[model samples]
Structures are given as structure tokens and as C-alpha cells.
Target: MTSRSEILREKMEELIAVGALAPGQHLDETELAARFGVSRTPIRETLIQLASMGLVVMRPRRGALVAELGPHQLVEMFEVMSELEATCSRLAARRMTPADHVRLLAAHLACREARDASDPDAYYYKNEAFHEAIYAGSHNQFLLEQTRNLYRRLRPYRRLQLRVRDRVGASYEEHDGLVQAILAGDGDRAEQLTRSHVMIQGQRFADLMASLPQLAAGELLAPGAAGRTRREGAPAP
Candidate 1:
């Protein structure tokens, strides 16, 4: 049987994924526990773990709420993702095995095939796979973990930008450059290319926010915007 904490965590993750709990929305313990058919203890423990992961914030005397990313915080995350990917690419040039190279190449080909087929979702998944293969090839657990966390944090933003016309094709071209750099063992070039590749998403996000005034207003007014000070009632993470 699943442990209480695990079950509660799954339920909470589901809630977050489905938009039942929007960014900056407070998490009601009693309501969540009741909804999940669990006790408050598991809910409390899970909330703490989530908060530590930057998924929620726990506030003093108040409660837990989803972590909100203001425009600045989103930019910071993009900056961090760029650095992480660059470092991973640089290290991967030194550490990648022949098998790793093959896998990365295959992932890139998969993305190319998907892009040629005009399957945006498939192309997106394959593109992620290509980077993930590179990340795993870097062979550093700490870096791997950091990359994974940042990817999750960037998911919503990524999805928002995915379907813009020609975006997938442009992304594939960027990946082509990244793969070429790594294949040639040009570590500095690889680092530069990967970092720029990741930052493109930041640019896309800024454009998106500018185009959609409503979303900007929502983000600006939302609690805990831009990774600011923790709210006392914010969920644990």
C-alpha cells in the first residue's frame, strides 16, 4: 500500500498539474485532506516537502499556497536554466561515452522526424528527450537534479510557447547547433549554444506576457510574485 505521504503528494501534484490550484492560490489543509481521503498529518508533511521543492510556500499562522512566479522570478529561472544547460553541455563533452553520443544523436533524429511530420507535441517531447539525454550524459547527480527541478518549474511557460507557428522548427534548428557543438567536442561553443538555446524560452515568455496583458496583470498581482519573500501561509517547499 502507498504511504500516506506519498499518496497525498501524488494527489497534490495532480491538483497542481490540472490547474485546480493556480499559482499563488492557498492550499487549504482540511479541504485537501478531506478531498484526498487522508489525514492532516500526511497533508502537513507533504506540504513541507513541496515547499522545499519551491512548489509551495508555508506561511506562519496562515497556511500553504502554490508558489507564484512573477516576471522577474521567471526570468531568473530562465537564467538559471541557461547556466545549468551550459554547464551540463560543457561537462558532457568531457564525460559522454560513445553510447551516450549514440543516444543523443538518436534523440535528435527523433526530434527531427517529429518536426518533419508537423507533430508539435511529439516534437516537443523528443526535443526534451534530446536535452535529457545530454543531461544524463553529464554524469553529475547534483547537476542532473538541478536541471530536472528547473525543467519542471519551467513546464507551464514552455507549454504556453510551444504552439506558436514555426516555433518548433526554430527550436529544432537550435538543437542542431547544440548537437554539432557537442559532437565536435567544442566545449565552450557547446556551452554558449546551449545557454542561448535555453534563454530563447525566456524571450518567448516575455513576448507572451507582453502580448497578453491579462496574464501580466494576474502575475503581477499574484501573491509571492517573482520568488519574493515567503508568505507565512505558503505551503512547505
Candidate 2:
């Protein structure tokens, strides 16, 4: 794929994350090309990459569609994400440079602005910068890469969680303590705080559930998922 496809892929990812391209929605390459002012070639390439990421599905005769992710599957991903981020936090506590500390604090304070405004979308973007500073501070390239991939993949749900009533303020409070723990170089506390901060469980899970717009249980479970994949092949000759 070319650089054009790469950019398109990210844009499409955002549409899916925001529910503009709802789960199980059909993706029409010809129409998409016209809408995005690009050729079908790049659109096809973008869909192929998204399919590999499990964010889309390619059907043998039916073109492509968005993949569905059920709540259970989403929770499983969040569980793993929490563990990875906790590890990053642990390492960051011991490894962050003074400059890294500066950036981290800057990002954290930026979240406060969004919190004061009570804008979940604004907080979501700022929160990403804050978490990313910690990820980079981990000083482990492999760990950083893995943590980021999962972070990117689970972003939609994380964004959704922030929309719960008063969640923006609570998340800011969580970050306040987490930033303190990391800044103090308290690895154990930082790790514990990250686990608590990122994991969706109990009341937090309920909050996420409540935040979801009404949809069928099965769809919620595996919304627009590629449960019916059948690889394309030429008809028998």
C-alpha cells in the first residue's frame, strides 16, 4: 500500500471508532473513493489493512464490512490493555527522564482544561497524549510498540467510557494520583494506580454498558464481527 492508503486507513479508523460507520455497516469502495476524493485502489488497500487489524471483514463475493465486537470481547481486550499499560507505568516510574516528566505534567494539566470544560471528546484526545508520554517513558521499544497497538485498537471503548456521567472528572482525579505516583518514582504504586485507572470492571463496566447505545445483545457481543468469513477463490475451472 502507498502512503495515501496509510492516511486513508487512519481516517477510516476514526469513523468506525466514532460510530459513524456503525458495526456491521457495509463499506462501499466506489462510493468511499468518490467521497474521499481518492481512487478505489487506495480504498481497497485501506480496507485490507483494517481487515488484518480485525476492524473490518472482506467477503468472498460481497466486498467489505466493518467488524462487530461484542461487549465480552471488548472487555477481554480492555483487561489485556490494562495489564500492558500497568507494565508501562511501572517501567516509566523508574526510567522517565526529567524532560519526560515535564512533558507528562504538561499533558496531565492539559487534561484539566478539558475536564473543566466538561468535554469528553476534548479530554479523550488530551488523555491520549498523557498516556502516551508514560508509554514512551517506559524505555522499552518492544513494550511501547505493543502497548500502543492495543491502545489504538481499544480506543473507541476508552472514548466511550469517558462519556459516562462525571467520568471526565473522575478520570482526571485518577490521573492526578497516577501522575503523582509515577513522578515520585514509586513503581509499585504507579503500576497499581494504572491498573485501577485503565481497567473496566464492576461499576466501571456497568458504566460502560450503560453508556452504550441500545442494540441487540448478540450484536453488542460481536457487533459487525466477521463471524461469517469465507475467503474468496476463483470458481472451479
Candidate 3:
């Protein structure tokens, strides 16, 4: 079971991910502690945890703020993620066991269900499981660990991407192709398909930017704007 700190951290992360906690917004410990009905200790611990995940920025005197990635950084991270996923797919094609194939198919089915339901949040978790199955199928412990770490860091952004119009359907189609390639033991095809599926460049990147305002408005808004407050350079929450 998750502890209160973990739960609070996840809630804060969701707020940031959806833009409820805007970029550069300071995290006031007192407010957060009051909001969550907890003491400042758990809030502080949660902030530290989020900082390590790249979702929170902790400055010398600025305390904690939501981390924001510039356009260049976003592209660079996506590029690395694409390549890592491609490598995993390639190795998985060659090394995956029959049981691994079964699990991958199950994960894909779960994603399809979530997509059909038009549930982005559900699809996001299912998507994570799908990719994780591929990582495990790669049969390389070090590579799996690295991929999982990066995947976690990229989770919020990736989840936002799925909110793009038609993205869920398109992603499901891509997963279908990737699953087939890996199952058929076609490493080259699997690598190419996985890379294309994940690389958010060209038209895809443009589309993401176009959709940002909508995502920020629809998903990121707090109950009342006035209820959301931040202090610059405040003490650690």
C-alpha cells in the first residue's frame, strides 16, 4: 500500500502534469500541508521525492517549484526515449519468450479497451504496462532498469500527449503494429516501428504544441484560481 506521503506526492504530480500547478509556481509547504490535512513533514518529504523525479525544482533559497522543460529539452528527451524504446523492441523481438508474448498481447488488449472507453488516464497506466512488458522481454536487466527510470520521468508528459485528439486511437494502432513485429521475431521491423511510434518529431511535435493550450485549460485548472497560491523563495514545505 502507498503511504500518505506517496499519495500526496502523486496528487501533486498529477496537478503539475495537467498544468494545475503551472510551471514556475512555488510550492508553499504551509498551504500544501493544510490542503492535504497533514503536517509539514510529509509535505517536505514528498517535495524531495518529486524533485528527484524531475517534476519539482528545488533551488538554494527558492524552495520547491514545478519543473518546466523548454522546447529544446522536450525534443531531446523524446529523442532519447524513442531510441531507448526502439532498442528494447529490437532486443525483445529476438529474446522474448512465449509467455512474454502472451503478456504483451494482454497489455495491448488492455490499452485497446481504455482507448475504446476514451479514458486517457486508464490508457496511460495501461500504456505504461505495455511498454514495461516490452522492456522485460528485452532480457537485459540493465537496459530494463534504464528504460524504466526514463519512462517514469517522462510519464506526465507522455500522459499529456495521449490527450491529444485522435492520439489514443493512433497510439493503439501503433501498438498493434509493434506487437505484431515483436511477436513475429522481426527485430528490424520492431525497431523501426517502435522508433516511429515513440519519436515525437516533425508533425507530431507540432501537433503537441498546438494541443497544449487545450490541455492546460481543460485538465490543469484548479477548483478556483484564487485557491492556488504560491510564495517566491518560501521555506521548504
Candidate 4:
């Protein structure tokens, strides 16, 4: 990434981290450039990239804004996300090299260590590592890129929803299943496992919307997720 692009990306993530760029808020290019001591050109380019990732919306003439995340949109996104991950897992089973297998197993072990230590933050990174390993193992550039983009787009929501009761434990178990499926080269099972992995969040988000109807309009899972059970009926891989 260019320095300006890197700066803009970091600042944008910071805005999300803070409450400055809450969901649905328009991104002011002029104001952001001035605040970050950068030029508008890089900001514009970065905004376009963010728009492609489904994190921002670029209107024809109205400039860019954070994407509005209603429950319906969340459901749609999660559905797509689950399909993409399932594809990744299916591909990984056939394409993964020995090195890829080792790296994925290491990620699973890291998650086990993180869970044993009760470190949620570390577990999050380890969880990411596990998914990324599978993405790389898939050996499809397009699928890998799309999977990564959606993962980043959903990061904030995952962090929020996973804070529900024993969600971290459940997430770790899912990771274990993924590792097992990959090591065994079970393409069908791998795809099934990953599809369920992502749809569980959608189910939680739906339940959350049911409990807090306010979230049905703006953001999908904020102000606490109601945390439903994992989606029980994912499609067969």
C-alpha cells in the first residue's frame, strides 16, 4: 500500500474503532484529509476500495459513506460470506500442500493455547489465522481475495456478536472441526463446516434484531447481541 493509502486505511479503521464513523454515517473526504494530514486523492482512492469491500457506499455524486447495515443486509451478507467460506474449504481440501496443512494446524494449536489462557483478544487473532490458512489453502486467488474482504468487513460484527455467552468456546470448537476436516482432506465436510461457521453469526444477528428492533433499521448487531443458537440447518457441502 502507498503511504497515503496506508494512512487513510489506518485512519478509517480508527474511525470505526472510535464512534466517529458509526454505521451509515457519510465519510467527509475534505474533513478526513485535513484531520489526517493527507491529500484528498488518496482518500478518494481508498474510499473506492472500501466501497468494493462492502464497508462503504459510493454514491454517484453524493460522495462516500459507511454502509448502512440493516438486519436484512446482514442476513444477505452472511449468506454470501458462508457460501464463500464453504467454497474455500472445499477447494482447500484438494489443493492444500503439506506446508499449508502445517500452517493451518499451527493456527489451530494457537487457538487452543489462547482459549486455555482465557485471552479473548489472542483467540481472535488465532481464529483469524485459522480462516486465513484455509483461504490460502484454497489455491483460488479470486475466492481468497473475496473471502478476505468479507472477513474484514464483518470483523466488527464478529467481535461484538462473539462476546455472547460461551461464544468464544463455540468458535474454538468450530476451528477444531475445520482443522480436522482439512487434515482429512474431506472436501464435503470441510465445506459444510465452514458454511455453518459463518451462518452461526447470521443467526445470532437475526436473534439480536428480534430482541432489539431498533437494530433492524440501522446497524445489525450493536448494543448487545441476543445470541441465538448456531444456525442448525446449513446446506450440505
lDDT (10s digit) by residue, model 3, range 1-237: 756676677677667755677666789999989987899999999899988878889988868887777778888988998999999999999999999999899999999999999987667768878888899899998888888767756655686788778999999999999999999999999999999999898878987777666544545343453233222211112
Tell me the TM-score of model 1: 0.75
Tell me each candidate's RMSD, in Å, in order. Answer: 7.7, 8.9, 6.5, 7.4
Q: Write the per-residue lDDT of candidate 1 for residues 12-120, one digit (tens) a residue.
A: 6534532346677888989877877878888899999888767789999999988777777778888898999899999888788899999999999998998999976
Write the residue-wise lDDT of candidate 2 on 1-237 in tens digits: 436666577778766665566667889999999878999998998899889777789999999987876779978988898999999999999999999999899999999998998777668778888888899899998998888777766766787788678889999999999999999999999999999999898999988877666321222222332221111210000
Stretches off by above 4 angstroms in model 2 are 214-237
Which number leads on lDDT? 3
Write down the TM-score of every candidate.
0.75, 0.87, 0.84, 0.77
How much RMSD separates candidate 2 from the native structure? 8.9
Alpha carbon deviation, residue 15, candidate 3 (Å): 3.7
Error of 4 at 174 (Å): 1.0
Best by TM-score: 2
lDDT of 2 at 100: 94
- For 175-214, candidate 4 gives per-residue lDDT tens digits of 8888888889999999999898888555576555553333
Ranking by lDDT: 3, 2, 1, 4
